[model samples]
Target chain A: MTTRTVTCEPQNFRRVLSSMCTEPHPLARQAASRFLATNPGDPTTYRTVSKLESEVVERLGEVTGQSDVEGYIASGGTEANIQAVRAARDFHDVNDPNVVVPEHAHFSFHKAADVLDVELRTVPLTERLVADVDAVAAATDRDTVLVAGVAGSTEYGRVDPIPKLADLAAAVDAFTHVDAAWGGFYLPFTEYDWNFADAAVDTLTIDPHKLGQAAVPAGGFLTQSRKIMDTLAVETPYLESTSQATLTGTRSGAGVASAVAVLRELWPDGYREQFETSMSDAEWLADALSNRGFDVVEPTLPLVAASVSERLFERLRKRGWRLSRTANGELRIVCMPHVTRELLESFVETIDELR
Target chain B: MTTRTVTCEPQNFRRVLSSMCTEPHPLARQAASRFLATNPGDPTTYRTVSKLESEVVERLGEVTGQSDVEGYIASGGTEANIQAVRAARDFHDVNDPNVVVPEHAHFSFHKAADVLDVELRTVPLTERLVADVDAVAAATDRDTVLVAGVAGSTEYGRVDPIPKLADLAAAVDAFTHVDAAWGGFYLPFTEYDWNFADAAVDTLTIDPHKLGQAAVPAGGFLTQSRKIMDTLAVETPYLESTSQATLTGTRSGAGVASAVAVLRELWPDGYREQFETSMSDAEWLADALSNRGFDVVEPTLPLVAASVSERLFERLRKRGWRLSRTANGELRIVCMPHVTRELLESFVETIDELR
Candidate 1:
């Protein structure tokens, strides 16, 4: 008899969380403890979930200058993109829906389009790695329901020409959705003129977990159009309905509470300070990498994408520095709130020694 | 100057967790306390989520006799059913994929098939209010990839003849999926000879929150086949990957952890005892309603589907009793583990007086 041995080890992601919040503040711990004591159902679960959702939405609204902004919490950026596409498709009532996405857009867009059976038209990127507005304009047809602009492209961490793409989408009377899952939480506080709300885009994706310092499964889609949200609103007699809408049926109230906690703990100054620090660190890292003779893709915002020679890449990996490499031989490094300046400096110093 | 009021009322669901495990069990409360602390993205956060998911899956597995069953924690029964269908379609290589579902099956089947572009063929129910085996056999064609048999159909609460459905599906070489979302957690302990594993069904939907006395947003599709799970495994360089498979990325590890906790606290026998208690209460309520001259559908497994005339439904609603009425004038009273027998008697007695 072959016995199936099941060794219960905590998952890798959980390990990361433990390490990240090693010495949590007393208030944070207390907030969590309070929530656990009261396992209420939806809308009444944790004070934090609903509070945080509204705070984030209001903060986003203030930044975008949109008063009618509505947000729905999602598991991650992928789910956010999926919901956005579904809403756009349903709103346009297109039999064969099409979305204009840049070649460098997040994989979630393609996954969403494939799952929803929407036709995805990819636009080429220019030399500077920004979305080619002309290519996007050319891709548009009567069947096009959405034009997806990237606030932060994964490969090079460069923001797409949202103003140009939004203009094109506007000309064709199609909805523009910005894939801001990586940028939305940061761009609001950045010095860059990337106005998500003002950029003619109707829908935007934001991952609080990525840049807002929230846990995973805390992404959202922010929309200014009430009509678009209503199109995706699923009302069932069995389901507890809320004025707030979501693609999913049951949501984790805990996830919502976590977001609320993060937002409250880090208000206007905290968010702005974190964004400024990220920008400074990103600049310093880019300069250090360039000084060490590596070709760096300077970000339009706070991310630094550098391309190391094949030999150098192998040597760096052997030295134990984990960095993401794109297909075009570019390595991406994000300046997260948790990533300290010393850690960045040490990484650069180690790279210099290897070079 | 106009002042905008931002009401930060944390939703009810998040608060519910605190109340459910408020006292008596320190470990469970401690686990819940730990989950309340961090945001969803914190890797350490899996303790709470994974506990919930694993608990639910293990309990369902014990009932189904498939210990090696892989489970993906989803938002609700709708998402669980959708994910199961998606996996079936992709695994079987069904071009122009279609699913065979009974006419009385839950609406989620139609919604999922619609989203996946899978043609759904509804088989008519027999006079016994169960899926007709002959109708299901006739509905299968070359394009049929999945056949769904309802265990406790929402309207009738009657378990379909799985033995017959399994034989039909085997003859057609299609995957047999059982939508036991409402009954999977209870039917195993009921006086019914329905073993999920013995029935040879490929996938089974179970909602622990529904019958296992857990919170909402905790549902799963348990499967014995690794091939079916692999079909839904989405891989990306940026995403977390483990030996275990999942449909969605960045799952609520806290929810998963809570599920595991629930199962550990309530083993198969414990669950069986709870189910037996609920079943007895259901039977009692059904008898009481019938004795009082109400047209009550017989107690089917875990639920009692009663047909209270339209006048009676309004009267019951006015009395502050929440009961679901079916399209065919049937009212469903789900006897959950938390629902006390005394409460059941009181409700039934009140109905008797009205009748």
Candidate 2:
């Protein structure tokens, strides 16, 4: 037998600036390594990681102004959003279920609707690129089980008109879900009333991996009560426990531990300072891009959407600039913590030379 | 901010044998840490990890004796199985779809059926504790989109008649899926012909976390043809790449990297030696338990299904022996690579004293 050992040397992996959220915190890495062998299928079978998961849920609730929140750590935004739709489908007891969302909602909503076979009714965005409440009201009906709005949309990072959407959903007796996967952690630091305290949201999808600075694949699903969570639980007869409330079986507890560690370390003040700096950096980048004759949108939640020609986009992409684009073909640059001023300045210098 | 770091020292976390797989290979840890910040969402955005994920898929295909197989890493068994069922549903274009499986199949099937709103028809197991081919034939009909069989059932670790089941599925033009989440890696070393080279299976769900000794949350979904994989792809307009063929968005590269590392380290010879040792250990443990007045079934894989009373189970569990039980109340002990002879000897000594 060959005595082989796999080692990941620092030189083998070069860090890039396009990766947002900075590097994972030291506490998060250590926590992940500690719980690498744990599976949070049942608290009874895996007690340590299970307790850590509960504490993480509690911290998420307290910070989001929903003190009674109940949920589990999902794989990522996709699983969390799918679970939210499933909860809404089961809770409303509708025969022909459908989910209503804005056209600018995350692609995860589309994946969820397709997987669940639920009709996805997408409302067109308003002139401001937010979910138009009038359109949502027009799209929703008796069969509509869920009406969702985004806190930080993927395209423009604009917060939707969630309060108005919630009112409309309440009138139709539909469950309201807020997909705050990218913007949940930042909303607390901003002066926006987008959390559960200010809205009539029934479920929320928060991803710690996005803005919370945890390790990868740590998306959370939160609801107001256990009665709602029970709808997604499945019975696992082989294990010591009889039931599990997760979309995937044998989930890794590493993500949960890393998220809890990061949240515990940077709770009240550290994250706020980081959010402030990231938004400021975004504003600075947007101003630089606009000054250089590129049409850029105003900054919101550390994301700047700009219009660039296909030729320029190809050039920038070939030069190793990781970029995102909207359906309308607007370029998106998320000024995460890792996207420093020096990197943006260098990018601007290149754009100036090209022009 | 306080510089409080979460340290996971070895002594701080105790190791328990209830975990089926051994501690992840050191290479797996290094790979996870190296790619902790990378995601496999878009190949253009995260080029290195995306390429690595593709190589891992190709390696998985070659190892499973399907050189032309195409697939991606999933979150776990549940997601993989669900995606297979979804592929079948979409490819066949069935208005009212249903899946037929043996009664001893994993509960993930139930969850998939519930989420997809597809009717699930379960055939009873034969008296020999394996999936009865005749019963499976009786349960499937015109509306059946999928016919699935378990390579190693969660309860008794008995492999179903996959060859016969696949023949039956082919007769009705249904997509055949083999859920080898528990037994995929082992079958390569055994004399069994349960791989893609031997059966007419369309899709297979193999979890590296179970038997491959990779880190957690590494489930794989492989298809016989790329045409079938295209059915599960969703267009993501925001990302540079317009399409994705995964259930979750922003999947962790840690699982993929770790899985590839371990699979490379232990391929043809290393896994065969480990499997032989594990099987021998199981036989010895089963003999010891049978001699101590317990009714134990001869194992097909490295699992012993013993008939033990609730009282004895409670006593053994209290003494730190993590045990599993079947729906019919039979005790289960999976003799994985981690469950060494010394551990079995200690368990036997305790049972000897109790008897």
Candidate 3:
């Protein structure tokens, strides 16, 4: 009898292993090595998990100018959104709570609503592809527990008018949650003063894995009010002696340690420098794409979304440039710390030639 | 100006580091290294995560002589129970769904109910501290969606009469979930011929971190029916992407890698030998405790719970022995892979001297 053997592709193997140690910098590697050498207990304890969580939150508070901040480490942006929705719903005591979101909001909001059985009210976008605050205000009702404002919406990478959304939410006594998963790390360092705390947003979800180059599963839920976090606490003696304030117990301390290492290494100037360079690269990519006759959306943010006139995307793919598509038929090229200006310029040149 | 410098105690520093890496075994170290090297995406996915969830179900199928078995990876035992409760509630569609559990059942079941807002009925235990099947049968009602049987109750580490409980669940058409979190990795290799799938269990929760010596955050939920697992799925555009099928998204591929490495390193014979040795150590500990006149609870499986006569506990603590207490004044000591017969014997000798 003959047996078949299964094997994984070499590139895929490389990508997977690289994801384990996502940090490009050497300090992150040292911190991870040291952490693995030491802390090996279950990371569910407040003493261990909370200390790391508070460290991240404290740094975020300093960056955003928010002092009374309470945050919890989560698996990713999705879990953070789910927990935020749960807290908002339980706080408002809405049996069939509703969330008002822009059409371009991240899919996490829709996923949160689906899991919690909360009604989702999708508002139309403005001409600039930003959330139409008026549409959101018009959609709000007494049953609305949360009004979501997108900070760097996935489609166009344009931040919603958070101040206007906060005002609307305040008028209706609804909670304002900013989906800052993509923009939280950038906005604070970028010239844009779009911090959720300053805009009076109640809750925000941020992913360190996306911008900080930490390993996967490093995300957080930031809220100005501690009361909101209290509502999500579930007591269990099996995993936790006290109440587990997060969605999952027995979390990986390695991820937390990695985040701490990344934050420590990139204190004040490091983050600012990286953010500036990425933003500049985004602008350069946007200009190149536009000069090549592509309609680029929200050319200001670190994400450049463009619509190809011909088979430019196919040609770019052949040249080894990977990109994701938005619901609005726009291709999004996100400029991370790893993507250099030269690389973006070369890719844009290839696109122009293909067009 | 003199600045006050903060200093950490050597023990405290060691404890802080130890919290991240709880197990002090060489195998755990080797596994962690291999885990760190594995990636969570594609080709590395198999090594990153113990997609052995399906393998476990397959093993269960073979053990029970049942063909239909399904399983999913979970963060830990608590998450597994939470999902099981959610699935039961949604599948049964019972208004104010209730779960019947023994008084000594792991607290995760109660926590799951509290989080889901489902009614929980705790049946009283027998004099031996095992689940009284008749009490569980009497506690059932039309509102009950699940009857939970603990394979190893945390207090006394006694396996409930699962066969009898399954018979009772069948009588009422209630779904039976076995919380074998501590015992799942042990019973398969031990003398316990009871197959979880054959014992009328619709679902079983297992923790590889506890007994299998994998990294923390490694657990699983095994089910005999794919239909049950389907009920926990939250279908939304954002979360229902090609990869995720659980409550969490973007999990640590490192933890998954650790689980796979631990499981692979300890296959059929490895598991059997380790568990058999642990059982023997447990038996030796029980005998030593009994000889010292401590009211040692008889071994339910491999666990030995004892009442240390309050005065004896204080004396043991004074002698530098760390032990956990139960609700009913019982001291519990788990014999993990890191714990050896020598350590158990030393503790027993100390107890004898103190007594």
**Candidate 2 Cα misplacement greater than 4 A, ranges:** A1-22, B1-17
TM-score of each: 0.80, 0.96, 0.84
- Model 3, A50: alpha-carbon shift in Å? 5.3
Q: Alpha carbon lDDT of residue A41, candidate 1?
A: 26
lDDT of 3 at A68: 65
TM-score of chain A of 2: 0.94
Instruction: Write the residue-wise lDDT of candidate 1 on B1-355 in tens digits.
Output: 1122222333322212112111212333344444432332222233444444555566678867787777766655677887778877877765688899888887777667656668989989888889988889999987888888888776667888887787787777888888877777677765553456668888888765455444334567788887887776543443222223443445554444445556666667767887788778878888887887777778767577777788886686566564555657577776665456876777766677776
With candidate 2 superimposed using the best TM-score fit, by how many Å does residue B112's alpha carbon deviate from the native? 0.5
Q: In model 2, how large is the Cα lDDT of residue A224? A: 86
Tell me the tens digit of each residue's lDDT in model 3 across A225-248.
Answer: 878877877654432245666766
lDDT (Cα, tens digit) per residue for candidate 2, span A124-236: 98888899888899999999999999998877888998888889889889988998888887889877667789899888988888778888768889988688788888787
